[model samples]
Target: MTDQTRISVGLQFGTQPPLNTLRAFLLGARAMTLDSVMVIDHFQNVFPTSIWDRDLTWLAAQRDTPHEFFDYQVLAGYLASRVGRMRLGVGVTEAIRRHPVLIAQAMMTLSHLTARAPILGIGAGERMNLDPYGFDAAEPVSRLEEALQIIHLCFSTQGPIDFCGRHFQLHSAPMDLKPARGRVPEIWVAAHGPRMLSLAGRWGDGWYPATVVSPREYAEKLAAVRAAAVAAGRNPAAITPALHRFMVVAPSEREARAMLDTKVVRAFALMAPPSLWRQAGVDHPFGERFNPLVDFVPGRYDRETMNAAIAAVPSAVVAEGPLLWGSRNQVVARLRAFGEAGLRHVVLAPVSGLVSPRAALYSLWATGRIARSLRRTSPGDGTSAPLLC
Candidate 1:
């Protein structure tokens, strides 16, 4: 098979910063060689929405920054206004909390506004968002599947869309929304479980697996997705496997680790849960294991537990896997390994300053250090993007 490799990149933003800040990030991300800019759709400004310490005296009192939480639709629409060609995505819009019709409508509008550069990524929402809305957490697997079907039907079907499922029932509702250029935005599913992976192959155009996954593990998952695609009578090669990598780059390993340990890990510690640590093979006193692979730091648990939970997961090990952290060459080498493993796109998590601080600074940093390295590698015989049989 011809490699036909094209590198695509995205930025993951959690909190809804000011419109200007987002605009700057989008502009900077584009300038930095980032192929896309993504915003995680959520209501909470901070993770572990439950905290016994209202003042957080345990971690040494740092003044809590007054947070402004923006609705995902508003943020995405605003973001669409500024960028011309850069791909815009929702890191994940939760299926259960959002009505499929509304979700589809919003994405279609955004796609039109951006002149057809939109990637819709959806996932099962966390308890913090779904529970308060009185949703049963146990039904996520079913809810997500049903919601996906509904969303796809709403976007792809012409005129009225009617559907009935265990979780949702849409009755022939009329929808005039049309995607700007082609069909509705490309659908990307953020998933980890076997069933979800299978669902991605069956319904998704792309898969956004997180940073904790090793290239080997990703290879296995990709294989599974391909199998699922074949079983579903879809073209296996039609699905694009993209990895989401959290990173901190510097001149040396120590400096890189320091930046990640202090900035990325620490900032997110209060939100990290036992699930995250379980994935990292770390034990916590809270009687929980953190699995960084599937855990979302914010909105998972409370601050104390979140802090203690993440402290257990070794940042170095997590970084060593799919993530590109360390010197430029080292980051490049790790990414090269993934590219060889059949990864064609990389979505970088730039948990750093606003884009004004450096327009596309992180993306530019990654492209300069990593993307350039891959370009020099010549795709090694032009067979890099294919799954090994």
Candidate 2:
């Protein structure tokens, strides 16, 4: 593995934190000089209710209630105005919920507002966001493929568009707005499966996969992406390899483990299919019980049930998964391993107690420390500097 590589570090802002907490974290990140900030695009709460409250009866009562989530585009614009230096973007938005033209226009607007082209991360539809809203969740990959094509046309083409696909169609669609930076925002695609990986290689400027993927798995998938890029006649090096994972920085290993044992983290792990757990070498207790294919419901379980299920799993098993939790040095070492494994970008999603103001501030400080350590120890003989994007 060559160490003469550059890595961009990003922080992910999701619905788990309240708006105030998110604002504080962003301000702290800017003060600490982190590279970029990305926000998740979700109409509903992706975090389990247990994370917010531990009381079983209270959780059950609020299970049917809507969760708080800000619109990502609007939030990105807001954050951009507040934090002028840090690159702002939506970690990912689904093509199913919003049209390609609108997404393109929104990104362009963000670019003009921020004075830099924001990263537009996209993915196929997730059932959690689609099913309740009555959007067609079928053939998500097909819809995503067509959506990518349309989005590309909207960004690159000069005149009106006329496209007809199985899932979406456009007839003389007007896309008159040009990007403020003289180019559209870089499109990053979140993909896990083989088909989606190929699409990322062929069309995306960056490839993003969930953090549960092991470093070895990331290497394999990245190889596949490079092959697909070569087959498509695009420069493979142009596609940035980005990984999104939850992180917790603590003073000791035990404290880190305790933080990862929260109901939210356990429930999040349970939502991953058993195959992914096995791939990550996680010995999860809920084998095939909450498989997305069989369960069909988004999240699969409510707070009480998920809490019970997570309680049965061993902490060691959870520790073995993709979460980055440890002392400062340990966290830095793990990140170095990932960089060695061909990861060019990493987006850290702080979990559990780290979402709190005090812990989040500490995490930001630790992140600055880690970023400096990576740069100092990075294998290149002090000649090539890693780009902070």
Candidate 3:
């Protein structure tokens, strides 16, 4: 484990782009001195219906939709060729959507091509995609555990993997590809629950958690994850803890707030549990009768209605907490908190809009500033390296 307060930053795609958007992220990440770049693996767009129309053009150009033959494996190959040094990975591939053998194969190919720069981030599959295929989302913990074991076996051995599990079975199917780099590619498991955390502790090289808002929350989760790793007979501290924060960095807090209003609020309204808003002491703008995620009919959103819906939730409750937003200084201050909490990396996920023109520029600017700040600080030597990887 590194002793420095190492900050390995990266970005996840927010929309389909014209290649230039990706170029911007790649360049921005480089400028910021970040260590990794990633993309989420999903067959379909994961946005609310209301925003789909506005998002389709970008999405189509950026990725192959779910069930489509054109997939990330192809894109990753091309990306690996073009981008150098910054580690690349699927932020997470759904465990139920593909077999571990296939996942390992793709990872191995990318690893070979990129000189073992690709890191594998796997998670339990989403029901929206797997249920149609007769897969059970209810068994995510068990399923993810099985998938990890299988993928590990395939990657580490020359002979075929032979194993049978409740969710998966592999027999004499060896992974023939060898990584060009001597080191095997790193395996990361994205998890938020204790059960999955235990699994990560035992097998994962890294742990990726969803949008972390505060240093307190980040520290708490790390504690649990490391504890689980220790209990599983692994060195908890060896595992790298990374956070993916929905960020909107600006010159000032006011502009960031407005961006949050127009973009973040609407975007989250579609994916986050509405109950979270209620926890913030806010009412559901669409009324208890309406689910904002219902199939969106394009050109149907009434501006007044939408604005009111967004306003129904308080900014303090909705945008600020559990998210990184505001001026450059503010974001830097918070990031330092994360460093103090024993985090090794933080992925700044700009709002979909921010990942574009206005926000992209700021994000690029902030990256450099942040990387410098982290380099100046030293992660203390209070703890021994525990295997959290």
Candidate 4:
């Protein structure tokens, strides 16, 4: 006997493709009932400039800039018309760049267009998205807390909203758009820290953490979220337990593990805080007291510095970076273990695809197989989204 909810699988492309390519991609996805398609919002990426010139990703050779990103909100609006029946939204966008009221309005608009419940994934602003553009990255949790309050106020009521807080102040701001008749928009917060986790419980429809945490640690953090929900007099069950995970699938376990030593993969590990690097007896290039990934500025590093830093990262460190890797069976087993830890929804990113077209094709196929193996569904359940299977 098991108490697992009907788990949903979602696909999240790490980068945006050309308009025609994206349209065709979604056309294919329309055949499956995937829970959601999440777009990443970023001005700069986690990968350093050096990797862009290498064979890390196919987009490298075609790019005008090493770090190029289309506006996620605009892309979401375009996708609303194309994604046949699946939910569509950005994985996480901060209120730091866009005002909280605007985010609320955008969610309201998308709800009317999409056939399924559209999700609004929020997070404390990332440094790369903020620092270069002159936005204050300090007290991000506090700012996000206030932003959530404002956005929540706008959605939960139809009246004028007035909120006074440390990071934001709103005076009788009018936001009067209602969601589709029966479709309610969801807010998935990317929370990992203690204060952020509590906010996820109090305000979010889903606790969508992107960090790499052990299943045991996920259970512990999940419990904290539930406790916070209970303290707020809300049903803890209302919040979907969701995660954003990176995976690598190859012909063999050895090949998969070997892929972790690539420039992009090594850079991914470097995105982790110095403490994680320290645990593996590796020195973080940015220094022991360096800020976390969310606070890191990737654009500032010269190619030489980035290459040196990435070279410093060992494959073993990447393996223990908490990223999922291995042959198909190993990957599936790990996902199943996480599913047992109350993971109801997950957005999977296959990073090995960056290595080559062959790796990408194999990973794509393996992902479908992996999804079919782990996601349980009732027979004849027409709503079951294809996990790429």
TM-score of every candidate relative to the true structure: 0.81, 0.86, 0.81, 0.92
Model 3: lDDT equals 0.65
Per-candidate clashes, comma-separated: 23, 0, 19, 1
For model 4, how does the per-residue alpha-carbon lDDT over 164-260 read when each residue is reduced to its tens digit?
Answer: 8998888887788877877778899998888999999998899998775567777888998899999999999999999888878887777976787
Mark the regions of model 1 whose C-alpha exceeds 4 Å error after superposition: 1-6, 45-67, 263-281, 289-307, 315-323, 352-369, 375-389
lDDT tens readout by residue for model 1, 163-279: 878878877789877777663688888777799898888888898876434577778888888898899999988888888766656556665565556523444442344444565
Error of 4 at 247 (Å): 1.4
* Candidate 3 displacement at residue 24 in angstroms: 4.3
lDDT of each: 0.64, 0.72, 0.65, 0.77
Q: Give the better candidate number (2 or 3) by TM-score.
A: 2
Q: Which one wins by lDDT: 2 or 4? A: 4
All candidates: CA RMSD in angstroms? 5.4, 4.9, 6.3, 4.1
Off by over 4 Å in 2: 1-3, 15-19, 48-66, 279-300, 314-316, 354-358, 379-389
lDDT of 2 by residue, 117-189 (tens): 6889898867777787788878888888999998889887888899999988889988988788554688989
Using lDDT, rank the candidates from best to worst.
4, 2, 3, 1
Q: How do these models rank on TM-score, best leading?
A: 4, 2, 1, 3
Off by over 4 Å in 3: 1-3, 14-17, 52-70, 131-135, 269-278, 282-311, 352-356, 378-389
